[model samples]
Target: MSEKRDMSRSRKLFITDKLMRLLLVGAASTSVLVVCLIFLFLFREAGPFALNPGLGKLLDSQWIPVSFQEEHFGVGPLLAGSALVTALAMLVTVPISVLVSIYIAEIAHPTEREFLKPFIEILASIPSVVLGFFGLLVVAPLIKTTFGLSTGLTALTGALLLSLMAIPTIISLSEDALVSVPYALKNASLALGASHLQTIFRVTLPAALPGIVAAVMLGIGRVIGETMAVLMVTGNSAILTASPLSSVRTMTATIAAEMGEVPFGSVHYQALFWIGIILLVITFFLNIIAQRVLKKYGMMK
Candidate 1:
């Protein structure tokens, strides 16, 4: 009777394990399907962008999409705007976030770290639209007054706002990476007559490099995809300018500002989808690089 009972229990557990495995596989498959569908849809809408609008126009700086006579879909301005804002934002976000993470992970007392972590998370939880409003009302005026500019809506303003948004992400992930560095390694460095700061810079930070790189990439990705905040404060001008003080419109901003008013199935509409495809490709590459670094570090299989 006991032997029969044991055999029955084993059979039931095996069946349950198989059922759970199938459910996990199905969920993962569904996620992949959703992503593929999105890519396909964007590609379908953007197919005519090349032929009708002509890829030749992309090299031109003029982007008069809604002009009365001869509308041009020059993408140079949008790409430049995005690159400038994203680069500037990353320049500000990376150093500040990494420094703060290092302080939190290595220097701060436990209670202080506990207090700071919650604030970082809270900042992250704040909605993008609210930040947009703050930038529009507060930061914009400050920039305009300080720079003696006609208006405050410029690439610098958008980059500052985006940096504010990206900081929490970079800090939280980087703090975790820094903290994950083994205590034994630090002890060994200390025993070798190295000071705390030296050990951190030479040993801990290097060991945490992969994770830090991943965090920075993710932060850059966030800055690239941001639309509402940049749209609200960037003056929405699609102009080719190298100056950070100049008003500009990013690809995401262009899509947000124009998509609703644009007529569906028009060449202009497909052009917006093409912008989405560009953003999708950039973000995809960033994620791939991040994952590769993590995998090399044995953080992922």
Candidate 2:
């Protein structure tokens, strides 16, 4: 009787596990299906434009889309603007995020960590629109006054806001990575007469480097995809310039600000969809690069 009962229980457990695995696979497949559908939709809308004669025009530096004379659809300015804003934002975000993570993970007391972690996470929950407004009304004016600029809505302004938006994600992920470093490693370092800082710099941080790098990459992803905040603060000027203090616009801002007003089935509409495809490709490659980095890190370890 006991042998028979054991066999039945094992069989039931195996069936349950198999069912769970199938359910998870179904869910993952559904997610992939949704992404494929989105890509297909964008491609369908933008295919003609991609092949159109304007492909040459799209490579130019200017972006004059609405004119009785002729319309230009160059993406150079938008791409440059995005690159500048994201690059500047990362420069600000990465150092501060890593330092904050270090403080939260290695230095803070338990009570302080409890308070700081929730507080920092709450920063991410604040809506982008609200942050945009804050940037417009508060930071922009402050920047303008400080720099004596003609207007506050500059790429620098946008980059600053984006960095603010990205910090929480980086800090949270990096803190988790730092905290996950094995206690044995730290103890061994201390036993070897290394100071706490030395142990953290030499042992703890290296062990957690992979996760920290992942956090920064994810933060870049977060900053790059932001729409409203950059839209409102970037002055929406399609200018090809590298100066962060000047006004510029991003691919996301272009799509967001003009998509609704653009005539359906028109070249302008197709251009917006094309921009969407570009963004999708950029993000896809970003994720791929992130995976590669993680894999390389794993191998190095």
Q: Find the candidate with the highest lDDT and give its number.
A: 1
Misplaced by over 4 Å in model 2 are 1-25, 295-301
| Model 1, runs deviating above 4 Å | 1-23
The candidate that wins on TM-score is 1
Kindly list the per-residue Cα lDDT of model 1 for residues 70-178, writing each as its tens digit. Answer: 8888788899999999998998999999999999999999999889999888989889989999999999999999999999999999999999999999999888889
Task: List the global CA lDDT of all models.
Answer: 0.92, 0.90
Q: Using Cα atoms with residue i matched to residue i, what is each candidate's TM-score against the true structure? A: 0.92, 0.89
Give the clash total for candidate 1: 0
The sequence of per-residue lDDT tens digits that candidate 2 reaches over residues 1-301 is: 9999999999999999999999999998998899999999999998788677556767866888889998889888898999999999999999999999999999999999999999988989999999999999999998899999999999999999999999999999888788888899999999999999999889998999988898888788888889999999989999988998899999999999999899898998998888888888988888778677767766223
Give me the displacement of residue 99 in model 1, in angstroms. Answer: 0.6
**Where does candidate 2 have its weakest 10-residue lDDT segment?**
292-301
TM-score of 1: 0.92
Residue-level lDDT for 54 in candidate 2? 55
